[model samples]
Target: MQRSSYRYLVVDVFADRPGAGNPLGVVLDAADWDSMRMQAFAAWTNLSETVYFLPPTTLDASYRIRIFTPRQELPFAGHPSVGAAWVSLETGLVSDTDRLVQECAAGRLPVRVVGTGPQRMITLRAPRARPVGIEPPPQALRAVLASLPTAGLQAALWNNGPSWWLMELEDDAAVRGLAPDLAAIAALTQATAAVGLAVFGRTPAGADHDLAVRAFCPADNIPEDPVTGSVNACIAAALDAADALPGHDGRYIASQGRELGRDGRVALQVDADGEVWIGGHVQGIIDGRATW
Candidate 1:
């Protein structure tokens, strides 16, 4: 079999500075590649997520993208969506449109870009998320949470595309000090069909961000994700549903991945109608081609 070369870009999503957020691989042209090839390449890259850009099947969409993790393909993912949009604009794939319509297994979604150059920001109207209900802590979940201080903590299940078990801790300290049982977490996620457990807490008063967040997904071959847009979106949706979020502000920032030495900042906004938008600044890191 003959292998083909493709243009690829590596980008950091939800970061104000380079190398401060979740890294994603974007294959700019993958029309000829099949699903197996995409998955193989994604696993080879060893990134949390990789995306392939192809021509849109629908006339309304500017382009279509497929998201893949190291293990399998995902219908949708937040950082991959944002990173794909940035790569599209940067590579002139959708130059004529300010708002990009993306087609994926999750359906068509819209992305808006603001500013330019290093200051450029991209926001995606997240897929509609709803609280599935609170999950009773099973034995596996209990094992994972045993080391963490859980007093006054609240947990719930939310679905945006991937199902997540969201936990709100008392403060940033609790969130940051977690040493989770990855084996237990993997067992729980696999048994429940959830992606993983996501924990967050309120930041110190007057801090630059409103919340501190961390995600654990050993089941997905990722021990921890640096910055996760989908999980943050679900957190917002869950908080808004319970009326627990800050009342005075519809827009806030979430700080994540600091424990891993990453400074990821995710921008979140809730519309008057209660729709959530997840966005942040994306930086292009590697401009190169891949042959496999």
Candidate 2:
């Protein structure tokens, strides 16, 4: 048997500072590797998500990416997309084009890079998301919502590529104070074939962020994702559908992973055409190669 060495980079996405956001592992040149090998490497890395970069199959795309979780492969993901784009630019794989098209299971998506150096930010246009349903079935929804206040909480299921149960609490405090039943959440996600439960609440009137978010995806082997691009994207879509997002300006910041002692800031914008763009700063953490 022969072993191959592959270049890999780890980056922190949606971070206010280095090491404060979700970490993503990227295999820079994985065109030759098969799906099983990629999955094995992703599981070994033990990151929330690991991506493989390959040459694009489409004329419009600059490159292609395959996203994998420890337990499964994903059609698309928020942080991995941002992290992959950053890696592409840093490695000189792609020029400083205004925007880069990424081919993935979700299809071709556009990614834009802004700023430079530590201030550089990468934004990805989230796939179109719509409300699939409101609240899981009565019994399931009740169990999942247990141990939490329900007076003003609103719930819905949204799907872009990954399906998530989105919940809107009364305020940031309520969202942060929640003590969820992980078992029930896992069961609910399994039953609904959802990624997990994502809860958000409005921040104070004059806070720096507009919303506070937390995502739990035990079903996917993630207890709590520090910063979730996909979930926040879904949140934006849900708010837009309800006409509850900031009307004056369609741009707002979301604070997440604070409970985990991480400062994960997600930048969000809803274009006039009603498209959601999720972005944040990505910091390179480790540069190394892997052999397996």
Q: What lDDT tens digits, residue by residue, belong to model 2 across residues 1-292?
A: 4348878889999985787999999998787889999999898988899999988888999889999988888888898988888888888998876688889999999888888756788999999888886443757778887766653437778998989999888789999999888998998888888888998888877888889899999987899988999999999998887788853478999999889989899999999989999999999888999887
Model 1 TM-score relative to the real fold: 0.95
Model 1 pairs in collision:
none
Q: Which run of 10 residues does model 1 get worst, by summed lDDT?
A: 147-156
What candidate 1 gets wrong by more than 4 Å, as runs, is 1-3, 133-137, 151-153
* lDDT tens digits by residue: candidate 1, 60-102: 9988999998988888789999888888887888884568888
Question: Once model 1 is optimally superposed onto the true structure by TM-score, how far is the C-alpha of residue 95 displaced, in angstroms?
Answer: 1.1
